[model samples]
Every structure is written in C-alpha cells, then in structure tokens.
Target: MSAGAVADWLGVACLVAGGLLSLAAGIGVLRFPDVLDRMHAATKPQVLGVLLMLAGVALRLRTTSDIGMIVLVAVFQLTTAPVAAQMIGRAAYRSGRVDRSLLDVDELAEER
Candidate 1:
C-alpha cells in the first residue's frame, strides 16, 4: 500500500468518527434533561467533532493554504466554543433554567 492510500484511509476514518461524534452531540443536546447538561453536550463533543473534521480535511487536502485555513478555523472554534458555552450556562443559571439539583456544587448560588 502506498503512503497516499494510507493517508486517504486515515482521512476517511477521521471524517466518519467526527460525523458520529457530531451526531451524538446533537442527540445529547436534544435529550439531556437540563440546560447545563445540554450545554455540555453542545460544546464538548461538538468541538472535538469539528476539530476532527478539520483534521480530516487537512489530511486530504495536503496544501499549505488549505491547512492554514483549517488551523484558523480550529483556533476560532477553540476560542469561541468554551466562551459561548459558559455564557449560555450562566444565562441559564441566572434565569433559573438550570436544575440546581443536578449540580454537585452550586458556587454561583453563594454569590446570589
């Protein structure tokens, strides 16, 4: 087997894994009992799935500009996802949408 074939196979694998993770994340967001749990589902696996998909695209493209674009996308995703999730979680908490019973420690409650 050639190196190119191996790379293609790896790329396909990454794409498939990423797709599955993304699907799971979507399902979790829909199925989780609370806002916090839904937020967790939206951010964690979704970010990883996006990164994996980018990796697969980079591997398949194998061009400098393409890889650079992918890196930029990855950077933006890493920077934005956590911040977005935190904001959403905070908003939910502030609106009393979060289920306090599910949290082991409600540090934010002390501030209230």
Candidate 2:
C-alpha cells in the first residue's frame, strides 16, 4: 500500500522478468538451427535482460551514488552486444556456417 512497498514489488518484478529473458535467450541459443539465429539469441534478449536487472538493482537501492556505475554497465552492454553479434554473424556467414536459405538479403554476397 505504501510507496516503498510498490517500489519493492516493481524491483522484484523487473528482476524476475530479466531472469526470464535470460532463460529465453539460453533456450533460443540452444534450440535455434543456425549460427545467425544463435547469435541473435545470445545478444538481443541478453542485453535487455542485463539492463532490466541493472534497473531493478537501481530501483531497489534508491540511491544516486551507484547510478553512474549502473549506467556505465548498461551503456557498455548496449553498445557492445549488437556489434559483437553482427561480427559473429558475419563471420558465420563468411565461414559458410549460416544457412543461405534462411536469409532474405545477401548484400555481403552481392559485394563480393
């Protein structure tokens, strides 16, 4: 009923949601049929899951002192995850690990 109680509940919910997203990412990586799909699984949901958990921690702590660290972590995760995924996906494609049939566009192929 109190504001503190609401904040606590919200923080817990965010953590749970993040955990579920992490689980989904793991399952997707394992079950996906291709390297590109697996890279997608490893990056997309994983980034959001980390950000959500960081947000939950921030909310639960209710302080400004650690905000910088949390923001740094989130920014680092957001910036690196997609780039890493793209590089890995490109490597998979170039190495002939990705299934050609699943791709709709092949601009890399066109370039070569």
Candidate 3:
C-alpha cells in the first residue's frame, strides 16, 4: 500500500471517531441533569472532537497553509473550551443552578 492510501485511511478514521465523539457530546448535553454536567459534556468531548476533526482535515489537505489554519483552530478550541466551561460552571454555581448534592468535593463552597 502507498503512503497516501495509509494517510487517507487514517484521516477517514479520525473523521469518523471525531463525529462519534461529537455526537456523544451532543447527547450528553441533552441528557445530563444539571448545568455543570452539561457544561462538562459540552466542553470536554466537544473540544477533543473538534481537534480530531481538524487533524483529519489537516491530514487530507496536506498543505502548509491548510495545516496552519487547522492548528490555529485546534489551539483556539483548546484555549477557549476550558475557560468557557469554567465561567459557565462558576455562573451556574453562583446562581444556585448547580446541584450541590451532585458534587463530590465543593471547593467553592468553602469561600461562602
């Protein structure tokens, strides 16, 4: 088999895996009971899924500019998802939308 064929197969695999993860993330966001749980579902798997999709695209495109753009997208996703999740979680906690019983450890509660 040629290197191109191998790359194509890997790219396809990444795309499929990413799609599945994204789907799971969507289902989680819908099914989870609370704001914190939904935020976890929305940020964690979603970011990884986006990165995987970008990797697949980069592999298929194989151009400098295309790969560069993909890297930028991945970086932005990694940087923003966690921050957004933190902010949302904090807001939910402050607004009393988070269920205290669902949390194993309540570090934020100590401040109150």
Candidate 4:
C-alpha cells in the first residue's frame, strides 16, 4: 500500500512485459516462413523489446547513471539492429536465399 512499494511493482511489471515481448519476437523468428517475414520479426519487436527493457531497468534502477546507460542501450539497439538486418538481407539477396514469393520488390541486387 506504500507509494514506494507501488512504484517497485510498476517497475517489475515493465520488466516482465518487456521480457514477454522479447519472447514473442523470438517465437516469430522461429514461426515465420521466410527471411523477410522473419526479419520483420527481428526488426520491430527487437527494437520494442529493447526499449521496453531499457525503460524497465531505468525505472527499477532509478538512478541517473542507470538512465544514461539505458539511453545508450536504446541508441545502440536502434542504430545497430537495422544495420545488421540490412547486412543479413543483402546477404540473403545475393545468395538467392530470398523467398521471392514473399517479395514484391528488391532494390538491393544490381539488375542486368
């Protein structure tokens, strides 16, 4: 019933929700049919999950330094995840591992 206890509960809730979202993203990685679909899985939820977890940690930690690190983590995830995704996508495109059935457009490969 205390305010501090209520805040702690909220932080725990955020952490749990974040963990669950990351788990869902992992499931999508397994369940999706093709590279693109799976990449979609890898991209959105991965960022969301990172954001959520960072927020959760910041809330729970409740310190200036923890918050700075959380912001850094969020920035790192936002920047790096897409670059990695692009690399994987390009590799898949070059190797013809792409599932064309699912692709309406691919601008990566040099067209003859």
Candidate 5:
C-alpha cells in the first residue's frame, strides 16, 4: 500500500517483462528463417529487454548516481544496437544471406 512497495512491485514487473522479451528474442533468433529476420529478432526485443531491465534497476536503486549510470547504459544500448544491427544486416546482404524475394524495396541493390 506504500509508495515504496508500489515502486518495488513495478520494478519486479519490469524485470519479468524484460526477461520475457529476452526469451522472445532468443526464440525469434532461433526460429527465424534468415539473416534479416534473425537480426530483426535479435535487435528489437533485445534492446527493449535491456532497456526494461535497466529501468527496473533504476527504479529499484532510486539514487541519482545510479540512475544516471543506468540512463547512460540505456542510451548506449539504444545507440549501439541499431548501428550494430545495420552493420550485421549489411554484411548479411553482401554475403548473400538475405533473401531477395522477401524484399519489397531493394534500395541497396543500386548501391552495389
């Protein structure tokens, strides 16, 4: 009934949701048929999962310095994940791991 208890419960809920998202990402990576799909599965849910986990940690810690560090980590994860996924996708495309038939727009096709 207290505010502190509410915060704790919220944090625990976030952690559980994050864990589920991470598990979904793992399953998606394993079940997806190709590189692009796999990368999609790996990046989207994984980033969300990490962010959620960090949010849970931040909520639980509830200190300025710790919260700042968590924010920094979340920012880093958000920034790097997409870039890394783009690189991986490009690599997969160049190496012929991507299925062209599934592509509705092949913008990169003109680049090469």
Candidate 6:
C-alpha cells in the first residue's frame, strides 16, 4: 500500500532471511561430517547472515546512529570472522585434523 509498509516488509524479510541463513550454517556445522565442511559453511554464511540482520535493523530504524552502529558491526564482522575462520583452519591443520579425502596429502612429511 504505502512505501513505509513496503520498507517494513522488506526489513522483516531481510531479518528472516538472515535468520534462515544462520540456521542453515548451524545445520551445516552439525551435518557436514567434517571440520573442513563445517568451516566452509560457518565462515561465509555466518558473515552474510549477520550482515543481512544488520541491514534489516538499520533499514527499519532508519536513524543515523542505528546506521552507524550497523556499519560498525558489519565492518567488525567482516574483519573478524575471516580471521577467526583462518585461525580455526590453521589450528586444525597444525593439529592434524583435516579432510584428507578432499585434498592432496601433505608432502612435507615424505620429503623429510
């Protein structure tokens, strides 16, 4: 009917989509059967989901402070999530918990 109504609907939809993506990521973590797959799902989708949620909230609020906070949060997530995921992957690798079926074997050991 009105632009406001449409915007509200869109905001709600964004939040719902974010929620669903987050749920999917969680399910992927539980269902993927390996750490590599879990990382693949958790890192990307979680970042996207958080961004979507911030977008929805920012759009719904439509205030300068809210927008600023949303931007800060999105930036924080964009920066930290990848670093965290990389750390987890590296930790897993150093500790020898990888999916060998999906990749080439480590040759360093053989060379040594």
- After superposing candidate 2, which stretches have Cα over 4 Å from the reference? none
Ranked by lDDT, top first: 1, 5, 3, 2, 6, 4
List all candidate RMSDs to the true structure: 1.3, 1.5, 1.3, 1.9, 1.5, 2.1
TM-scores, all candidates, are: 0.96, 0.93, 0.95, 0.86, 0.95, 0.89
lDDT of 3 by residue, 1-112 (tens): 9998889889998999899999999999999988988998999898888888888888788999999999888888899889999899899999999889878999989674
How much is 53 displaced in model 5, in angstroms?
A: 0.9
lDDT of each: 0.93, 0.88, 0.90, 0.84, 0.93, 0.86
Q: Give the TM-score of candidate 6.
A: 0.89
lDDT by residue (tens digit), candidate 1, 1-112 = 9988888889889999999999999999999988888999999999999999999998798899999999999999999999999999899999999879878999888774
For model 6, what is the C-alpha lDDT against the true structure? 0.86
- Candidate 1 vs 3: which has more TM-score: 1
| Residues forming the 10-long window of minimal summed lDDT in candidate 6 | 103-112
Q: Which lDDT value does model 6 have at 71?
A: 97
What tens digits encode model 5's per-residue C-alpha lDDT throughout 34-88? 9999999999999999889988888788999999999999999999999999999
Measured with C-alpha atoms, the lDDT of residue 38 in candidate 5 is 93
Question: Residue 95 lDDT in model 3?
Answer: 91
- The lDDT, on a scale of 0 to 1, for candidate 1 is 0.93
User: How would you encode candidate 4's per-residue C-alpha lDDT over 24-68 as one tens digit per residue?
Assistant: 999999999888788889988878887887787777788898889
Q: Residue 2 of candidate 2: its Cα lDDT?
A: 92
After TM-score superposition, what is the CA distance of residue 39 in candidate 3 from its true location, in Å? 0.8
lDDT of 2 by residue, 7-98 (tens): 88898999999999999999999999889878989998988899889888887888787878899999999999989988998888889998
Candidate 6 Cα deviation (angstroms), residue 70:
0.6
